[model samples]
Target chain A: MRNRQQGRVIVGFLAAPVILYTVFVASPYVQAFYIALTDWRGLSAEVEVIGLANFAELSGDPVFWKALLNNLVLLVTLPVVTIGVALFLAFMLNAAGGPRSGEIRGVRGAGFYRVVYFFPYILSIAIIGVLWTNIYNPINGLLNGALRAVGLGGIQPSWLGDEKLAFWAVLAVLVWNGVGFYVVLFTAGIKAIPASMLEAAVLDGASRSQIFFRITIPLIWENIRTATVYLGIAALDAFAVVQIMTGGGPNDSTQVGSFYLYQNAFSYGRFGYASAMGVVLFVVTLALSAFTLRATRKERIEF
Target chain B: MTTATHDRVSPQAAAVGPRRSRSARAGSSGPTIVVAQAFLVLWAVVSTVPLLWAVISSFKSDPEIVADPWSLPKALRWENFARAWDAASIGTYFGNTVLVVGGGVALTLLLSAMAAYVFARFDFRLKGALYYFFVAGMTFPVFMALVPLFFVVQNLGLGNSLPGLVLVYTAYSLPFSMFFLVAFFRTLPGEIAEAATLDGCGEVAIFFKIMLPMARPGLISVGIFNFIGQWNQYLIPLVLVSDDSKFVLSQGLANLAVEQGYAGDRSGLFAGLTIAMVPILVVYALLQGRIQAGMTAGALK
Candidate 1:
């Protein structure tokens, strides 16, 4: 009787969240999947169930492919560079030690460096896009100005205007803004390593390089894995930055999947087609997440 | 001969030890130190340049901004801030942002924490499945549900309202928030709650008095994260809210920037961007240590 009573209390505690989740999160997904099969124009009394027509349209939609490609590019570039650079910088920060070392003169500025590096991550993407737009402005922007300063005025090119460089340019801004968070993640990971391990490494005649690669790097695999999965999800869900900066423009070279989905649903009012695309994105994200979890699953190393 | 073998081993160790020390000492000394300093300084400058450029450009006249975008402001145009504020109706937008973000954070923490507590404290049939059910919600991309969510909001007659946005934001953030909080709550000792129960407290009271206070750090961490997420939310508001009066800072700023045009006075745009960024920056600056400490705690676990 007491055990049953305890179970009831637990169920009562869980009821609100489960109901809320079902209503808000899970229900919408089922609804979206249903809507994808119909000719729903976002608002209308009459709705037609067109079967796989929406998915059919998606298969041929040029913009959809463009957006998918953009997402792919983001997935490729962001996770590797952001996580790698962050881990590298974190390793550097950890090795430098606190200011008491005084061996590295710049170590005093570590706190300031951390804050400054993280500053951009806090700002809205709209601001980041606007800031970068000015930086990339062909005529009077900073990049062109620097080029002029360096006597390379003739090579000044339109950053957002050029089809080839526009995506890469926007990506640079995304990368610059994103690295700080993972840096913090990896820094925390690095700091948690036991001092005794390093002392033992020293005692074993291991050089600094060998210690870093073999010991520190191997130890922080979990952090690296977490950072990778985060960056992957972020890449898949990227919308604000592209939407704000290019609006997926310059001949749609910068069109990302999420932005495209937004455009379809809200701008073009192709609700059904957008729903199909959304489902595709959802599946891809799920698969990637599953893959990450599987790949990163390993026996935890005890220190 | 045995002594000779010992001497051989000892001498090998002795010979390698000083060389290692010498290199270690040199490695910790001047040249590498200079290199590390140079690298950090370069990275710092690279990171700060865009922000500095934005701030400085905001102070320049329109013509000057266009003519010399990278130069020091010839004169500080403090009026740009006021102009942008008025033009964008930033005051209204700021209020709306506070309402949505604030409500969203509160609701998220309240609901997710309760759920997290239940998941942590109670075990029942399909408990693992129930927990994973919530975890699965994290994988559902926001864009996927945008269409139905829009319809759901419209059907409920809550579209374009602060309450509507709050509902959507809360729903969206719940999965991750719950995930983090569950881990945190699970780490809490069950003995406290058990003791509270033994003291004749009800489950609700035990949660409120004991578990809630214990989960403060986790709640704060999740709260700050949700605050940032909701504050910076763009697409949800874009789809759900059509009224300019109800626009959040992101949409408001974007409209202001577009209206101002690329050639349009960037001073006002930059000023507006700066205004948009201030609250987030302030929150970050205020809670940075907590944020770092919380993240470290969460990750290192």
Candidate 2:
């Protein structure tokens, strides 16, 4: 009787979720591969399979290449810059407090600083895009307004309209939106370090920089690695920000892969061609995840 | 090598050394702290000033805004918000968003908790395989599934409907919820479950009456995370629902900004942005601690 009841409970609990996952998440993922081979415009029931045709076109698609290149630039730069700034801020917040009588405590109002920094992460990406677009407006935006207020009007360029500045402009927003979460993340990692270890280093006449470089980073390396992977994934799928802010550009200059795929599928109605792009992104995402995990591997340092 | 040399030189007699170095450390960190504080202040300003500017600019007329963006509003124009809410249909979009996100988060939590509970507690056939199947969904980006998923939803006749969007949101959210909550359920003690079972409790009853209540904190954390995610969701709603009346706030606000290009309701547009932002801001302020913890919890693993 007990075994029978257990079976009933298990089956009951798993059924809905199983169906939902299979129908929505799992099936779509599997079908994307099959869909990539066909020239299905999605307006008709007919799908003509053209083997390796979509991939061939993708290689020759210059706009797609530009998009991928932008993603690559973001993947490299976003993690390094965000992590570097966050580490500095986290160390300062958790350990850079003027040491009071041998115990290394965080700075004054660390909680306040954290709350302030993390505000952007909670806002909708759409809200951020809208807000930043206005801020970067050449004539009446706050960025230029501030620049002019400070008598630097000559350098106030149209941020989103200029092809050269647009991609970097979007990237800066990504970094801005991302840094706070890592700050809170790294702060937690730093707080986990046993007080005795830090005190020992302090007693041994380690400078602040010495303590940060030698003690803090190595202990939080796992957190850093986790952060790198998450940020890398985010950098790959920067669709909403690019779409809302630049709409793939002043001249396709700020195009990223995910947004480009979105454009091809929805705007252009080339479902088969877009699916091929999706498949390529799938491979790149897998490869990047694997490469990041392997590249950031360090000998585990037990606390 | 540094540890060895330090140990050899000190012979474990450096307890008082920090006090001696206090003045020297202060001399160095004093200047550094000032610079660091300066940078932190600058960043805080950078983080918040734009948002404040938006809120402030929402109260200014177009002429005032264009003439001097930096100047304070001559008078608070509550009409801008009125225009955004009524004329631009932000109110409708806000209601739709609340409905969809509410349904989505509720369904996600219930289904994820059920699946997670079993994975955490039961030892069944294919259990490892099943758990990993759900967990594996978290690794891939969602855009890969978009084209096919669009067809799948439309085939099910869910296109442009709120319930359809809710179901899709629940499906997408399951992976992370399962990953987070499975670990959460494993940490729960099994003794209460066993005791409840011995007390003539049905297997389902034991789970609902005893274990579910016990997992409140985990549920709350995952619930908040899901709430924020579904609330701020853009790409899915952008794809699934195209009707203006049915659009979520993010999609609707994006539409509003685009529509305002030459229509010159700039202040109204800012008002709509402010309207969409206020609830999130208020909630974040109220539950900043819990929200921060919940959001960052997934990264700790």
Give per-residue CA lDDT, model 1, range B47-154, as digits (tens). 888787777777888888777666788778889889878865777888899999989999889989988888777777898888788877876677789888888889
**TM, chain A, every candidate:** 0.88, 0.98
Q: TM-scores of all models?
A: 0.89, 0.96
Can you write out model 2's per-residue Cα lDDT over A1-303, one digit (the tens) per residue?
A: 999998999999999999999999999999999989998898675899999899999999999999999999999999999999889988888887643345687877789889989988889999898889898889999989999999998887989999999999999999889888999999889989999999888767778889999999999999999999999999999998999999999899999999999999999899999999999999999999999999989998898
Query: After superposition, which runs of candidate 1 have C-alpha atoms over 4 Å from their true positions?
Result: A1-15, A96-106, A203-207, A293-300, B1-21, B24-30, B295-301
Worst 10 residues of 1 chain B by lDDT: B22-31
Worst 10-residue lDDT window for candidate 1 chain A reads A97-106
Q: Give the best candidate by lDDT.
A: 2
What level of docking quality does candidate 1 show?
acceptable
